[model samples]
Target: MISVFPEVSSQYLIGGEWKTSSKIKEVRNPAKITEFVGEVALCSETDVTQAVDAAENAFKAWSRTSVDERAKRMKEAAEKLSTVIEEHVSLFVRENGKTMVEAKKDLLRCVEVMSKGADTLLEWWKPVHVEGQAQKVQIRKRPRGVTAVISPWNSPMILTFKRAIPAILAGNTVVIKPATYCPLTVMSCLKIIESSFPPGVINIVTGSGSVVGEALCGDTRVRTIAFTGSTETGKKIMSLSSNSVKKLYMELGGNDPALILPDADLNEAAIKRIRLGILRASGQVCSAIKRVYVHESRYEEFVDKLKKEFERVVVGSGIQPDTTMGPLNNRSQFNFVKELLERSKQIGAQVESIGQKLDSASWEEGYFMLPSIVTNLSHDSELVRAEQFGPIIPVIPFADLDEAIEMANDTEFGLRASVWTSNETAAIDIADRLEAGAVFHNNHTVFQNLRLDFPGIKESGLSQETRWGGLELFTDCYGFAD
Candidate 1:
C-alpha cells in the first residue's frame, strides 16, 4: 500500500545537470517485486569519465574556497532539505525495503551527518608549527582533489553522502556513484543539495558497479576513493586504485557480536539488539549484530526470551501501519540468508523459523522474509561466523568471560561488538578487551556521535566517517618552511 515517489528520476547528475542515458535499469519495490518504482539510467564508463572530469575541473577552484564558506553551503543545503524530507523518506522505504521507523532514521541520519559534517569544519583544520633546525615550518592541510564516493544500496542516500559531505566540506569536488539498485534515491538527495554549491561541485552517476566502479577507482582524475561495501569489493577497489595510489577510505563488512554477561537484563539486551541492530534495515546493516554470546547462567532463559521477541515481530510491507519488519532488499540477499539458515540446521544447530508471514499469500512473490532465530549453533558454524546480512541471528552460549572474549575474537571481521552487564566495572573491562573498531558497554548500532571517529579494527574498515577524522581523511599534508 505504498505510493510511488513521484519524482524518482532515471537520470544522472553530471556537472550540475541531469543527463539521460540510452542504457536503463528498473528500480523495483522489494516488497512488491512486480511493481516498478521507476526506471534508472545504467551509465557506462564514458559517463563516469565525464562526471569525474567535471569534478576534477571544479576541484582546483573548490579547494581554494575557504573552509567557512564550504561549511556554510552545506548548512544551507541541510536546512533546504528538511522541508521536503518526507518525500525522500518515502523513496527510501519504497525502493530500499526499510521499515517506516528505519527509513526515518536513515533520512534523519543523512541530514544530521550533513549538518554535522558542516559543523566539524569549525575545528577540523588547523596549521601546525614546527621549529626545525634553523627555519620555522608550517604544516598545512590541503584537499585531495576529486574524491569519489562509491556507496552501497542498503542505505543508499545516506551512505553515499555521508562521505561525500565531508569531501565537499573539505574543499574537494565529489563524484558519487550510488549502488544501481537504488540510484534514484541518491540522485534525489543530490538534486536537493546540487544548487547549494557551484556547478560541478556535486555529482551523482548511476550504473552497474562493474562499469562505474571500475571507472571511478581506476580514474587517475579521482584522487581519493571513499567506498562502503563488502570486504571483497574493498579489495578490488584497492587493486584498482593501486596504479594511482589513490587515498582509500573504506568501511567494509562486519560480523558484529553482542555478548550478554550474567546479571544483565536478558530481555532488554536480546530484544534491543534484535529490534534495533539486526532487524533494522532487515539486517542489511554493515555493523549489524550478527552473533550473540550469552553467559551459561542465563543462556536458556535468554534464548526463550529472544525467541518470543522474534515471534512478536510483524513482517509485511513497510507501508503497513502495524508492520514492524519489512522484506529483504533483494533476492541474492534473501537466498543467502535462506541457504545459511538451512545449512545451520544441516550442521546440527537448533534452527527455529519463528517466521509467520504477515501477508502470507504474497510474501514469496516479493522478497519478504520472516525473521529466523537459530540456537545451539557451534561458535564455528557458518551462521555464527559469517554475516547473514538478514534478520536471522545465531545465539551461542558461553561458560565464562574468558571464553566469551576468545569466541568473539575468532572472527575475520571486527567492526562492532557490545557487552551487557549491570556491573559498570565489568562492562567497561569487557568493552576494552573487544577487538572491534567501536564497542558499546550495553548497546550497539551503526549510529555514531558525529564528533567522534567511527572506524573499525582488523578487516572491518580502513578509515573514519565522523567529524575530525572525516575531514582529515580527505586532506594531504602540505608542510613547508615558514
Candidate 2:
C-alpha cells in the first residue's frame, strides 16, 4: 500500500476537541484506488446530537460577542490557515483526485473566503437609520442560531468555508458535515482554524450522508441549513428541514449552456478559456458548461478548434507533473459517465472521444476516461439535456439567436448561462432573456463568476451563495423603535 499523509489527523472535531468514533472508514486515493490515503471516524446519530447540544450551549456567549471582535478573529484564523495550506496539497490530490495545481488553488481559496466573508459581514451589519417617522428608528441584523453546513466532495474545502465563515461571523454556532468521500482535507483545515473560536463554535462530523446528513437537517436545534450538491439531495434536505422550518440556503446542480454568436472571437486564448470551462475538474463542477450552442455559420470552425484543444489534454494521476487532467473522484460518478456516453452512441449521436492517456499501461487502475465531444445530437437528447457531470460536452448548431435561446432555456435547471459576441449590446439583450440565475457576457467559469452573488432559478437552487447575499442569509433584520 502506498502511504499518503498518514500522519494527518482525521478524527471528528467536536466541542473544540478531537474525538474518535467506534466505527472507522478507510480513505482511498481516487487516482489510484488500491492506494490508502487515510481513515475517518464514521460518526453516528448520537454524535450528531452531542455536537448540536454543544453548539446550543456555546451560542449564548458567542452570539453576544461584538461584531468587530468576531471579524478580527476570523481574519486571524484565515492568516494562520494560509501558512499551513501548502502542507496538505498532496493529501488533497490523493483524496480528491484534483491536479496538484487545482488542489493548491482549492485550499488557498478558503483563506480568501474567510477574510472576505468577514469584510462583508462588517459591511452588512452596520445599523441603518430609517427616516420619515415621528420618532427615531434603526434596522440591524441579528444572527441565526446554529447553522448546519453540509458540503459536497468536488470542491470540499472552499465550499465548506463559503458557508461556515459567514455563519460564524454572524455569531451563529455551526456543525459541519463534510462529504464522506473527501473528508480529510476539510477535517485538516477545520482542525487548524478551530482554535480561533470558543469551544463548540466550530464542529465537524464524518459519516454517511444518510446518517449524519439527515440528522443535521432534521434536528430542531439547528436554525439554518446551508448545503451545496445535486438537486436530488437538495430536495431531501428541504424535506428534512421542513419539519422544523429551518432557514435553507441551497446551491444545487446546473446544466449550464454557452452560446457562441457568429461574430464571436475564437482566438487561441478564448478557445483555451472555453475548454477550461468545460473540462475543469473533469466537468465535476456544478456550473461547468454542459452544452454549447454555436451559430450555424461558425459551428464547424468552433468544433474543429475545440477538438484540437481536447486532443492536447493528458489524463492520469493528479500528482504527476505532466498530467493535465485527473480521474473522476469516485466509482459511482465514473460509471455514470461511462453509461451516459454509451447511451449517446446507441442513440446515434456523434460522440468523438479525444485526448491522450498519460499511462495507457495502467489505465484500468483508476476511474479515468478521455474527454469527449458530442455533436449531431438533438436538443432534447439525454446527452444534451442531463447534467452529465463528466468531461463529455455537446456542441449544437443554432441557425439564429432566437433558436439558440430557445434550446438553452429548455432545461429544468437555471443555474447559469453565457453568451459570446463582439457587441456588448447584443450580449446584454440575450442575457436578459436567458432563464438562469446569472448570465455572463463572454466567459463563464468558477473564477470568472466568483465576485458576484451566485443564485439559481427554477429547480436549480434556493436563496444564494457568495458575496453580500451569502452573508445576509445567515442573519435576520430587526427594527429598533426609539
Candidate 3:
C-alpha cells in the first residue's frame, strides 16, 4: 500500500522569482490515476515572452563573465544540490512513475553531470591559435544568447540539467520548458538550482507545447533551441526555428536494436542485465532495446532465458518495496503500448505477457502493464519496426551474421545497438558494421563514457549531450587576428 503524499503546486520561475498564473492544470499520478498529484501554471504566449525577455536581458552580463567565475558558480550549485537530492526522490517517483531506486539514481546523476561540467569548463574553452606566414589567428568560442531548453518527461531533471547547465556555464542565459505530463519534480529541482544563479539567468515556463513551444521556437530573441523529444516534435521545432536560423541541438526518438551471436554465452547473470536494459523505467528510455536479433542456432535458447527473466518482473506502484517494474507514465502511452501489443497479435506475432501483478485486485485501476516477450515477428512487423517505448520487445531470429546486420539497420532510427559474442574480435567487427550512434560489445543500454562524441545518424538525433563535444554545441566559434 502507498501512503498519500501532499499535493504539490508548481509555479513558473521568471527573472529569479516564482510567478503564478490564473490558468492552472492539474497533475495526476499515473500509478493511481484518480489520485491528484498537483497543479502547474498553464503559461500562455505572454509568459513565454516574459521569460525570454528576462533571459535576453541577462545574456549580455552572463556572456561577459570570466570562464573561471562561471565554472565556480556551477560547481557551487552542484555542491548545494547534492545535499537535497534525496529529499525529492519520493516526489519524483509519484510524478514520473519511476521506481524509487531509479528516481534516486536520476537525481544523483543530475548532481554528477553538473559537477563534471564545472570540472571540464576551463579546459573546454581554451582558445586555439592558428599560425601562418602573414599573421597569427586565435579561434575563440562564444555563447549563443538566450538558449531555449525544452526537456522531455522521462528523466526530466537530469536531461534538462545536462543541457541547461552547460548552456549556462558556457555564458548563455536560458528559458526552459519542462514536459507537461510530469513537471512538478523538475520544477522543484529547478527552484533549488535557481538560487545559485543571478536574476534572469535561469527562467522556467510550464504549458502545452503548441502554445509555449511555438512561442519559444518562433521567438527571434531565442538564439538556440536545445530539445529532447519525439522525432515528429523535433521536426516541428526545426521548422519553427528556421525563420531566425537558431542553432538547434536535438536528441530525438530511437528504436535501438540488440544482436546475440551464436558464440555468445547466455547465463543467468547476462540475462538479468539484458532484462534491466529492456524493462528499466517500464522501457521509457529512448535508447532502450526495442528489437532483438538472435542467431537461428541460439534463438530457442535465448527466447527461453528471456521469457524466464520476464517472469520475475513485479508490476505495481513505484513506491512498493518489492516492485521491480512500475506503471506507464501516462494514459496516452498506456493506450499506445496496449494497442501496439494487440495489433501485433492480430498480425500473427506471438505476444505473451510474462510477469506478475503485485495486486491483481487493483490492476486495472492504474496504468500498470506486464512485461511481454514477442516472437514469430518478421523484420518489417509493426512491433519490430516501431519504437514501442514500453516493456514489450520483439525477438527475431536470423540465419547468419549478414542477415542479422541487414535486419538491424532497416529501422528509420539509429540511436544504439549491441553485439554479443565470445570472440572479442568478432564482436568488434559486428559493432563496427552496425548503424547506430553508439555500439556495445556483449552488453547494451549503458553509456560507459560521457566525454566521447556520439551523434546518431538518420533521424535518431543531432549533436549529443552533457560532455566535451556535446557542450560545444551550445556555443559558436569566432576567429580573431590583429
TM of each candidate vs. truth: 0.94, 0.97, 0.96
Distance from true position, residue 314, model 2, in Å?
A: 1.3
Question: How many clashes would you count in candidate 2?
Answer: 0
- Clash pairs of candidate 2? none
Candidate numbers, best TM-score first, in rank order: 2, 3, 1
Q: What is the C-alpha lDDT of each candidate?
A: 0.82, 0.89, 0.86
Cα misplacement distance, residue 274 of candidate 2 (Å): 0.8
Better of 1 and 2 by lDDT: 2
Model 3 steric clash pairs:
none
Q: Poorest 10 consecutive residues of model 2 by lDDT?
A: 1-10
Using lDDT, give the best candidate's number. Answer: 2
- Writing each residue's lDDT as its tens digit, candidate 1 over 1-482 gives 12474464678888888887777888889999898888788888888988988898888788999888888999999988777777776678888888778788777877887888887787767687886558888888888899999999887877776788888888999988888777766777678788999989998888787888899999888899999999999999999898887898888889998998888876655465655676777788888889889888988887888777777788898877688888898888888988888888887887777745778888776788787778877898788888789988888888878999999999879888888888889887887888899888667765567546565878888977554737888888887884
Q: To one decimal, what is the Cα RMSD in angstroms of model 1 from the true structure?
A: 2.2
The TM-score of candidate 3 is 0.96
When sorted by lDDT, best at the front, the candidate numbers are 2, 3, 1
Candidate 2: residue 126 Cα off by (Å) = 1.6
Which regions of candidate 3 are displaced past 4 Å?
A: 1-8, 131-134, 452-455, 465-469
Whole-model alpha-carbon lDDT for candidate 2 = 0.89
